[model samples]
Target: MANSKWSHTALLVIDMQNDFILDDGLMRVDGGKAIVPNVIKTVERARQHGILVIWCDGGIYGEIFWLKVVREHDPQGRDVELFRRHLYSQGKVGPTSKGSPGAELVDGLVIKESDYKLVKTRFSAFFATHLHSFLQTAGIHSLVIAGVQTPNCIRQTVFDAVALDYQPVTVIVDATAAATPDIHLANIFDMRNVGVATLTLQEWCEADA
Candidate 1:
C-alpha cells in the first residue's frame, strides 16, 4: 500500500487535547504522551510529501457524552442525571459548541496556519463537523489517522471514514491510547480486522517507495 498510492491522502489528527493527554487532567489517556513523537513524525512526513494534513480536536463541553457514559454504566446514577441536565440545559449537543481552547489542537505539531483545522463535538469527525466537506473540497480520497483514545474517537473516526468510502490507513504507532494497554490492544485488533488498514509509522513514511 505504500508506493505513491497515498499521494492524495490526508492525515487527520484527532483530539490530542491537554485534558486527555496531559497530566493532572479530568480525563487522561495513559501513555498518551508516548504516541506524540510518532504522531509528530507522521505529520511532518505527510507534509514533506505534500499530503493534506487536517487536525481535528474534540471540544466536548459540559458533558452530554459523559452523562451518556455514566447512564450506560449506571442508569440510576445521580452524576449521570446531573450532567445530562446540565448539557441539555446548555444546548451543547451539536455544532453550537466549538472553538474552545480545550478543543484546540495540541502544541508541538507542525501545523501551518493554512493547514486545515476542524472542531468536532462527536467521536467521528465526519459527523456534524465540516471535516467531510473539507476533505471533499480538497479532493482527498485517502486518510491517515492519528491521535489519542483508540476505543472512542479514533475508532469512530476510522469507521466513519471507511463507511464514507475514504481509504483510511491508520497508524497504530501514532493513533491510539486507552485507559489500559489491554484495552488499547483489543481495540487496535478489532480495527485491524475490520475498518482501517494498519500501517506502522516507518511503513507509511516509505509510502512512496
Candidate 2:
C-alpha cells in the first residue's frame, strides 16, 4: 500500500526482547540477532510513512501470573498445550519473566514515547488483550508485523490479526526469524498460503514509497 494508506496500518513489533535476540539469552533464537538491522529499518520506514508503531511485548507480570495460575488450576496441564505443559508443570520461569533483563527489548530496537506498547501473555497479541479495541479506536485496519521466532509469536499474532478481520496483514520476511532458516521460510510459506503478505524489508518499505 501507499504511504497515504498507511494511516490505517499499524506495525506490530513482536517479542524482539533480549531473551530472544541476544546470544546469551535464555531462549535465544540465533537468527533473531541477524534480523535486528532489518527490523530497525522497517520500524524507521513505518514511522516515516505515518504508520502507527505498536510494540507487542511478551513478558509482562500479568502473563507470568496468568500462566502460573492456569497451570496451577489444571495441575495435570490438560488446559495447556501439549508441547508447553512440561515446562509449566516443571514451574519453569520462561524468558519473559517480569522485571527480568530478558524481558527488555533488544538494545538497538527503539520504542519511542509516542509508540503504543501492548503486553501479551500468550503467543497472540490479541489474546485477552485490549489490542483489538486499541487498534479499532485508532482506525487501524491493516497490520505490518516484524519480530523474532516466526513459528510462534510472529505467526500467532499474524494469524490472530487475520481472524480478527484485519485486512492486508503483512509480515516482513527478512525482519523476522526462527531458530533456523528452514523454519523461518516454512512459517513464511504457511503465512503466505493463508493469504498473509510476506515481503522483504526493502520491498515493504518501497511499497509505501
Candidate 3:
C-alpha cells in the first residue's frame, strides 16, 4: 500500500484489551482470541502506509477516590446503558478498571510510543470522548477499525464514525470477532448495509496497492 493513499486515514483499534481477548480474562470473548494475529498484521500494514494508529480501550481514568465515589453514588447504574445496568448494579468491577490487568492490551499487539491512545468508558469510542475533535485536528477523514466483539463496541464505533462523517470507515472482518460466527456475520452485514467497507485483512492491506 502507498503512504499517500492512506495518509489521511486512521486505524482505530477498539477494545483489544486483555479482558476481551485473553482466555482467562473477566470478560473474555472466546472468538476474539482467534483474531489477534490478523489484528496485528492489519496494524502493521496500516503503520506501513503511514496511517495513524489509535488504540481505543474501555478505560476511564480518574483519581481513585473519584471512581469509588461515582460507583457508590451510581450503584444502581442509573448512568450506564440499560443492558449493563444490572451488571454494574451488582458491583461488578468489569473489564478495564483502572490499574487492572484486564485493562492492558493483549499480547502480540504492539503499541509503539508514536501511536495514539484513547480511553473510553462507553461502548462507542466517540461517546463522551474527544475522539472526534482529535481526528478532526489530525485531518483524519477515514478510519480502518480492528478489534474485538463485533456486536457491541465494534458496531457502535462504526455507526458513530459514519454519523461523524468519517467516509470509507472500513472494518477488517477477520481482525474482529463476536461471541459466535453468526453474530459476527450479522453485524458485518448491518455495517455493510450502512455503506461501511467490510474487508478481510488481506483485502484491506492491498486496498491501496
Candidate 4:
C-alpha cells in the first residue's frame, strides 16, 4: 500500500505519562508498564507508515488524570479536578502536574518535533478541548488510539470519536491497559460491541507492510 493510505489517519497516543504508568507512580495502573513496549512499537510503526502522530497527554487522560498531564495547573491546584486537587494541596506534588516529575511522559516515548501534543482536562480528549477541530482542520478522519487505563480515558475517547463520526476508530489492544487483565478485556469487549476495531499492535503495524 502507498504511504498516503494513512494520510487521513492519525495515531493518538493517550496518557502515557510517568505518574500513571511507572512502577512508583502516584496512581499506578498495575498493567501499565507491561504495555509500554507495545505502545512504543505502535508509535514507531505509525511513523514508518507516515501516519500523523498526536500525543494526547496531560494530567487528566486516564480517569481525567493523564489527559491533564500535558497541561500544567496553578500551584494551589485551582484548575485541578475536585478529587485530585489534594495531590497538589499543602505543597504536595500531583501526578502529571505540569512541571512536576510525574507529569512527564515515560522514557522511550518522546514526542518528536514532527508530532503534535494535545492537552486535555477530562476523560474524553474531545471534551472541553479543541482536538476535534484540530483533527478536522488537519483532514484526519480516522484515529488509531493507544494509551493507559482502558475503561476511563480510552473508552470515553473512543466513544466520542464514534459520536463525532470518525470512521475506523482503531484501538491497539496490547498498547492499552488497566488495573487488571479482567478490567482491560471486559472494556475491550464493550468497545468492540460499539463497532470499534480492536486489534493487537502487531496486527495493526503489519497490516500495511
Prediction 2 TM-score vs. true: 0.82
**Candidate 4 per-residue lDDT over residues 1-209, each given as its tens digit:** 22777877877888888888888998798999999999889877776666767778421111111112144456677777798787787887766777777778889887654445687767777888888887787677888889877998889999999999999999999999999999999999999999999999889867776
Candidate 3 at residue 10, lDDT? Answer: 78
Alpha carbon RMSD to native, model 3: 6.8
Best by TM-score: 4
Give the better candidate number (2 or 3) by TM-score.
3
Q: Which regions of candidate 4 fall more than 4 Å away from where they truly are?
A: 58-72
TM-score, structure 3 vs. true: 0.84
> lDDT for each of the candidates?
0.59, 0.72, 0.73, 0.77
lDDT of 2 by residue, 47-142 (tens): 666677777841111101000000011334444446655643566655556666777778887555444457676777787778888778767788
Candidate 1 on 14-115: residue-level lDDT in tens? 777655667653356786877888877866666556666666731111110000000011212222324433443443331122333433345676445454
TM-score for each prediction? 0.74, 0.82, 0.84, 0.90
Question: What does the lDDT read for residue 122 in candidate 4?
Answer: 72
Using TM-score as the measure, name the better of candidate 1 and candidate 3. 3
Clash totals for all models, in order? 0, 0, 0, 17
- lDDT at position 145, candidate 1: 74
Residue 6 in model 2: lDDT: 67
